[model samples]
Each structure stands twice: as structure tokens, then as C-alpha cells.
Target: MDSFSHAFIIAIPLLLAGNAVLVPFAVIGAVIPDIDGVFFLFPDDEPSRYIFTHGGITHSIAGASLLSLVAFIGLYLLSGISWFSRFFPEGVTMMAGLAILAGAMLHILIDYLAYPGIPLFWPFSTEKFTLGIFPGPSLMILILSLGLLTLILTGRAGVRHYKTYLILCLVIFFIYAGIALYANTETEGRAIPTMDPTRWITIVETDECFVVRPYDILYGRGEEISYRKYTNITPDELAGIARLPQVQRLCYHSYIVTAERRGDTVILRDPLREEKVFRYPLDHSSLVIPLQETRSGPLPKNTDRP
Candidate 1:
């Protein structure tokens, strides 16, 4: 979710509860997890730095707690300042810290629902878990959030109606989630939501290939859009390639990856992004490694057997 949507969605509950004092703090917390986005400004060539990338450790439970702790301390110290206390008479309290923590957790929850999910247990485990119910970037969400924000800014929507607005947002999210969940059940593999709520992309993995197709909640699954075939690299050779530092970093961020042998090198890429099903920019890009560098020598074309 975008920062705007994250702020508004988190603020709704606080507003409804009349905890207006915590709303600003919570909103700040909501966007704090995204601070890792600054990593994107620099090249991610170092495999050791993967944990610092967007949607990496910061999105994890441990990372969130650490961030919330730092943020809480900052808020606490700021509240002690006489000038700062004048504006926020309530000052920082335990409840304020909890509110910030809650906002950060909510941010993680929202991202978990979207594509190429977060590693909730990062540092401990790099495996990413995603419901794949919502598209990475939803035009619908952006427009609705912006419109609602406009109303609040213009004083057209009063605080009294916050509950009603929250209900509407929940309804829309659930409807989309419900459809995607049902579609996933009917399919063999995962169902990835598209920009259009009604449509989805399904990926069914096989021993040698991954079958990708479009699906519709109202109708049914459509024709195959992509068939990513795995390179016929030997188990030992493939294991060595997987062990490569660069490939390990890519695996940390991508849910599914496909390897293609090209001359003396093997290219690793996320099939979803490679197929353009997930249109949003990804944290990891394709990686190419020379085959001679693996434990085994250059592989024979289309033959894994020694």
C-alpha cells in the first residue's frame, strides 16, 4: 500500500475511537517501515546488504519492534521539550508507543496481503509469506484514498463519519480478498490478484516448468500466458548455483525464480516480473552467473546428466 493509504487506513480506527492524540504518531509509525526504501537509491550489488533492502528485515516482526522502540524513544525525548509539549499537551506515553507499534504492525499486515510478501520472521528466516489477494499497486485504492483524504482536508467529511468510511474500506478489501481466496482454492497453485479485482493470475509449478494463466472470478481461468521452463542443470550444478551469494540474495526477496542457461552463464529471474504479471518495480533484479564458476563445469546443452 502507498503511504497515503497506509496513513488514512490506520487513522480511521484511531479517529473512530476518539484517540486523536495517537493518530499522528501512528501515522508516522505506519510510514517508518518504508524507511528501508532509501536503500533503493543505491545499487544493490552487495549480496550481504540484501537484508537492508526494501521489504527486507524492516518489514519483519523483529524489525518492526526495533523500529517502534527507536521511534518511541524519539517521541519520548521530544515530548520532554517544553516547546514541543505545548503543541502536544498529552505528551508521549506508553499508549502512544503502543499506538505506534500497532501502526507499524498494521503496515506489515497490509504488505503481507499484497504480492511478493514480506519475511515476517526475517534474520531468523528469509521465507516470504503472502496471501496474494491484492495487487502490489491498486489504482482503485490510490484513487479512493486520495478522494477520502481530500474530503477530510476540505472539511467535507467530519470526524463523526470516520467509522462509516472505515467500514466502506473494509468492505472493499474483503470483497477482493474473498474473490482471490476462492479462486486460489479452485486452482492448483497460487492466485495472484491483478490491478482489476475481478481478474487474477495463477501460477502452477511442475517438475520442469511453471504454468502461468489468467483467471476471472466471475468466469474461470483463462489461457496460459507464460510457461517458464527450468534449465536442465544437474542437481549438483544447480545446488552450487543456488549457493552462490548473488542467487541467495535474489531468493531472499523473490517467491519464485526461473533459471535459464545462456552460453557460459545462467540467468536467474523472478518469473512473475519477467512475465510482467506483477507490474510494479521489484526489489531484486535478474542475476547472471558464469557456469564455469559453479562446483561443476559448464553444463552440456539441454542435458543435466554427467
Candidate 2:
């Protein structure tokens, strides 16, 4: 979700409650999860380069909790100083921390529905929980939110107007997202009969890699394909690569959790990026990765699905 959508969506409730001091903190925390992107700006050769992969730890519940605690301490200390006291009300720091926590939690929950889902419960379980329903952001939602924001910030009436617009925005978002999620969920795992013979999901899996075939689903049968993971590498090879922190980080973001053998390279890709598999021109997300260079080997066979 865009920062504004989350900010207005989360902040309005606090505004309506007559605790507008928390609104700024709520908006601040909402965008904090994306700070992981900063790691990509600077260069690092070691595995630490992947230390803060976008949507890795910072998007997790634990990460959010830590940030909330940080916000609490920092703000509370600032409020203690006489210089900052004029701007901050008594107990505002504590309330701001709670607002931060609430906003961040909402951010994570919304992102969990997007493709190649977030590691919300990582360290405990690597399982990616995703609805893969909407595109994760709706322009409609943003527009409605901005309109309601105008109403909340400047209006003829006071609390009554703010409350109405706030409720309206929340209701509209829930209804819009709920419907899309429901539709996608209904279509997700099953292959529904169709007049078209278009392929839905096609993966060529072997003892090694799963080469996800490129196909469109909108024009044809709505079938879902699932696969199991296997690797041709021996225990020794697996152990060596597993030790590399970068490889572990790559695997962490990968939903497919499988590897392929490229030309003298060990390739691992998140199956969710299947559309990029056989593109004539490889894009970044498409040309996902080759874990580490190794012995060149025969490629996997083509296993077409019915």
C-alpha cells in the first residue's frame, strides 16, 4: 500500500478520537517498514548486502514491535526536555507509541495479501502466508482516502464530519478489498471449466529446478498448480551453500524454495515470479537469481501439465 493510503486510513481514527497527536506518529510508523529499502542504496560485497532485503525482517511483527519501542523511548525522552515540551503534550509520547504500533501492524496485514507474501512469522516458520488477491494497492482506495482526508482536515462540521468520513473510508476499503480477496481466493486453487484452453500455471519440475512456464490465466481455464521441492545437489553441496548468509537470505524471500542449475551456476527463484521464466527479454524480477556458481549440469526435463 502507498504511504498516504495507510497514513490517512490509520490517522483518521486517531483524529476522530480527539488524539490527533498520535496521527503524525501513526503516519510515520506506517512508512517505517519500508526503510529496509535503504540497504540497497549503498554497496556491500558480503552476505550483509542482503541483510535487509525489502520486506524481510522490518515487515515482520517482531520488527514492528522493536520500532514501536524505539519510537516510545525517543519521543518520551524528547518530551522530557523543556525545549520539546511545548510541542508535545503530557503522555503524548506513550500514546504516539501505541499509534505507531497500530499503524505498522495494519501495514504488515495489508502487505501479507500480496504476491510472494511477507515473512510475518519468520524465524518460527518460513511459510509465506498470502492471499495474492489484489495488486496490494488500489488507486480507488487511494482516491477515496484522499477525499476523506480533505473532509477530515478541513470541513464545516468538527468531530461529526471527521467521524463520518473516517467510517466511510474504512468501510469502503474493507468492502473493496474483501470482495477482491474473496474472488481471488475462490479462483486460486481450483481449475474451473472454461470455453478457452488457455493454460493457467505450468511448471516443469525435476529432481532439481522448477522452470515455471509462461501463460496467461485471465483468458482461459482457472487452474492452480502446486509443486514439491527437490534438489539434485548432494548433502555436501547443500551444506556449503546453506552456510553462506546471502544464500539463506535469498531463500528467505523465495516462496518456491527450489533451485535450478544454470550454465555453471546454481539458480534459485521465487516461483511467484513465474511470468518472467521464459520472457524473450529477461527483466530483473524475471532473471531472479543463480545462488552460486557450480559445475555445469544437464537441465531439467519439460513436464507439461494437463
**Residue 131, model 2, lDDT:** 54
Give the local distance difference test score of model 2. 0.56
Cα lDDT of all candidates, in order?
0.75, 0.56
* Per-prediction TM-score: 0.87, 0.66
**Tens-digit per-residue lDDT, 82-123, candidate 1:** 888776688888988998999999999988888767878877
Q: Model 2: per-residue lDDT, tens digit, 235-296?
A: 34544355344555555444345554454555554555454422211212222334453333
Model 1: weakest 10-residue lDDT segment is 297-306
Stretches of candidate 1 off by over 4 Å are 225-229, 253-255, 282-284, 295-306
TM-score, model 2 to reference:
0.66
Clashing pairs in 2: none
Model 1: residue 160 alpha-carbon error in angstroms: 4.3
CA lDDT, candidate 2, residue 51: 35
lDDT of 2 at 57: 71
